[model samples]
Target: MTEVDIATKAPESDAQQDSSTNEPTDASQQMGEHEHCVTDRPTPAGQGSTGEIIKLNGVDVYISKPTDYPHTPSRLLLLLTGGTGIKSTNNQIQADIYASEGFLVLMPDLFGGEKAPGGKDTYFADNSTSLLEQVKLKAVEIAKSFMIDMWLARITEAKIMPILHKVIEAAHEEYADAIKYGEGIYAVGYCVGGRYVLLLAKGSHEAGNDEESGMVKAGPYIKAGALAHAASVTPDDFKNLQAPLSLVCVENDALFTDEVRKVGEDIMTQDNLEHEVQVYPGVPHGFAVTGQYQESAIMDAQVTAYEQMLAWVKDH
Candidate 1:
């Protein structure tokens, strides 16, 4: 459970879509043709008490509430998933874990109906005799697969932002008293989910339009956020961040590379934003959510990262 601050730096990761980054304005114009992709929300897995699915503004959201929910002033969090979406067993478990810690968790189906092949342990290799070999096998699996590319194409930041805003607005209305009591919203993201949290942390602003006046926009509906093994995030994202943030980085990641991290830290510092970056060594991407925890290091880092996020929430 060791914590290494971003005092030093290093590579890019697989399952990444960097260099050409988030331009939500362009995406907004192209939305009409792809409305079907963004509008088609998925149904709940009906897994009993793990969580419950409710339609929030026509989007199916998996919600995990604290036992004393509504009766207690518990903070609310939007649990953003990786490529696995909300129905994945790992995300459900994660929502429950947050609930147990006294936070009402809401996870929306960002992928609509489609989800990654594996749930939670999506990166684990099959029948690997050793942990190191398993890591290698998983690397090959990501490298050789077309799923990441397809996912990038399907889940653009522009398409998902409106859905997230709608969910936040609906959740705020549905739990008005509870949210007012606990203050406001917070967010947590894993991998692809990580990218959105960054966008959210930037808060709402005008991205401009065809008119000279431009349209005002709002979003993310979060007071703060935390991210683990974020993918496809660019330097500009960090520069634009307006809310406090905590980042959990893995030793080996192609998506959130060393250069990218350094740039992020520099920009965050220059902008005078509150942020903390911690690195967990000897692990692959997605280790925070889906690592093989039987191994001591993996388990320790996973637990430590979760604690780090919780601490950030409480501190702010």
Candidate 2:
């Protein structure tokens, strides 16, 4: 599609805004001027041992460097939250594992900013006013509203600005504890964040492909540079998918059935780009980082994916 076609439409609609948050929103403000640059500020806490975690607006984001190597520089991995809550035991381990691999990690708290990190249950209504409390609680409704605003803003930036800022600070914080990393950059994610890796990748690529408009918003087929190296059960962004892509789906992810995932991958493969879809046995949605994983198998898969990506990056 042409820039004229994409730009003519606004950035977001009312329901699109609702997917990320639960609040009465100013549709105009929700689609604030697109952030062209990362914010200039100190890193947020739980970041580098020396780094800080601050609120990007109201969301909690932790930007940190690897504390082990302390002297070398490294690449970055921006970890997106799983849409409903704070770090899960498995996710925390995944982030730490990446750090151990000599990469900087940015864990943005998309919901903690709203004081309602209640996961899917966050939407569960309270019933105390009477036996039948059909009315939505004012407080729950309020948090939901505010959250949507922040959520949309984060999507606009992906985790780029925060990850960049962290790398800068970590150069000082863990100057010696780093490793020589990928020359330019790449992204990996999980759950909602995994989906984000694709969206951000597409946004990254879409910016290049659809130059007239400059960037794709947080919408369908709006992702840039994501098809390649992206891990997901759903890969329907077939036709417009631009990156060298790979897909990993759980054995039992109902919404992400193996057939559907393959269909997505098949589309990419037919596009003549490198694309593959593999499903793990006994895996479930959010199962990629658990202790139950076969260490050798997982490691082999990781190496394969990373190597494939580096090679593709070299050619692309």
**Local distance difference test, per candidate?**
0.66, 0.41
Best by lDDT: 1
Clashes of each: 5, 32
Clashing pairs in 1: 10-258, 11-258, 12-254, 13-254, 13-255
Write candidate 1's Cα lDDT for 1-316 as tens digits: 0111110000011122122322122222122112111121122245324788889988889999888877777888888887767766666777888888888888998877675533112222223235576456455444434445566667786677767877876877897765776677889998788888998787565555212223345643578899998877788878668889999997646667878988998998998989999988875566677323334666678789999998897777
- Misplaced by over 4 Å in model 2 are 1-52, 55-59, 68-70, 84-89, 112-181, 203-236, 291-316
Alpha-carbon deviation at 71 in model 1, angstroms: 1.1
TM-score of each: 0.74, 0.48
Model 2 C-alpha lDDT per residue in residues 17-75, reported as the tens digit of each score = 24222432332222221110111111223443334465443345565556764466666
Summed over model 1, clashes come to 5
Best candidate, TM-score: 1
lDDT of 1: 0.66
